[model samples]
Target: MNETFKPGPEAVEIVERESCFRGFYRLDRLRLRHRLFAGGMGPQISRELFVRHDAVCVLPYDPQRDAVVLIEQFRVGAMDKAANPWLLELVAGLIDTDEEPEQVAHREAEEEAGLQLGALWPITGYFPSPGGSDEFVHLYIGRCDSQGAGGVHGLAEEGEDIRVHVWPLEDALQAVKDGRINNAASIIALQWLALNRAEVRGLWV
Candidate 1:
């Protein structure tokens, strides 16, 4: 490891923060200044931040069959980015207040794909967009019995319209290569599985 010094949260100064908008989610404007690499603090600047509950994404992998479960749903953010707004993604949901990420992972898998997960393997946690959002995502690979995992599933109360697909693990990885699996959480989970498939299977055993 490099012996370079790294700054921590104490390095940044928050001059002011206020809510700009709040509805289903929130937008906040912040005036902040941070320590510069050379020596002193940089000039204060304002930036808009998107604030939301942290999220959990679980990729259901069946070591027995070497398959993975995925879901398709419409994402408003992709309206202008992709030809089709519907994206193939992993099972995911925001962590409700007081809800643990493990619980969200299990609940989302069941709600979005009609699959039950057992023995989850933590993949990673990250900020999907650190520059604009404080939203952090926890990623996991859950072991499942994909004997007959397929079809449409999701809660009607939340207006969720999800279609489930069970594919050979290789095919799912191919989707990432082909740009079909475009979401950050899904891509990260799938790539992690690809690199550690055998190791994950060993853990299940």
Candidate 2:
């Protein structure tokens, strides 16, 4: 939800009840302080949310082959929001309490695509959705063998049914433009690859 509010000494009311559901990710129910205008000062408002989430997205670049591995799955959140349920996304997962982002990336790659990562090229460490959630994703481009290591793979117990595809680097970028790939992480990863394709391809996969 794209919302804007103004800040003043005005009082805010919890017009509705707030609740939270804790799962792999937590959902927070909020009744805004009130809808006040920022008065042309730009949208400025603070939230009471303080969540810490660690995630990783694998680019899965293959230098010699000029390919990348990606996974497709049905996203419930998107369906709930009236968006397309099936989504093309990068290999990603939330970091458990003790795991590092890099380790999570590698682990997710194997779990979702059955590929072993070679070298990892880290992009940036930032928040994915900051307004309401304290979620953050640690982005990385990992080199891996994409010859015959990609296809359908996922943990059935987790209700995950993922389809892995080994895509030519250029075709993947084209898919991004054509809206065939419609997930934030996937879009960002592809754009990053577009800008750094030469350098990424120079490295051994």
RMSD values, in order shown: 2.3, 6.0
Query: Which predicted model would earn the best TM-score?
Result: 1
Instruction: List model 2 lDDT by residue over 5-115, tens digit each.
Output: 545546355545444666655666655555445433323343555455677887888888888888889987788764578887889988876988999988999899998
Cα lDDT of model 1 by residue, 1-205, tens digit: 2234358898899999999999979999999998777767889999999999999999999998889988999999999989999999989999867889999999888989998899888899999899999999999999999988888899999999999888999999898999988889888898888889888888785
Q: Backbone clashes in each candidate structure, one number apiece?
A: 0, 3
TM-score against native, each model: 0.95, 0.77
Name the runs in model 2 displaced over 4 angstroms: 1-20, 27-52, 80-83
lDDT score for residue 167 of model 1: 94
Model 2 residue-pair collision total: 3
- Model 2, residue pairs in steric clash: 6-36, 6-37, 6-38
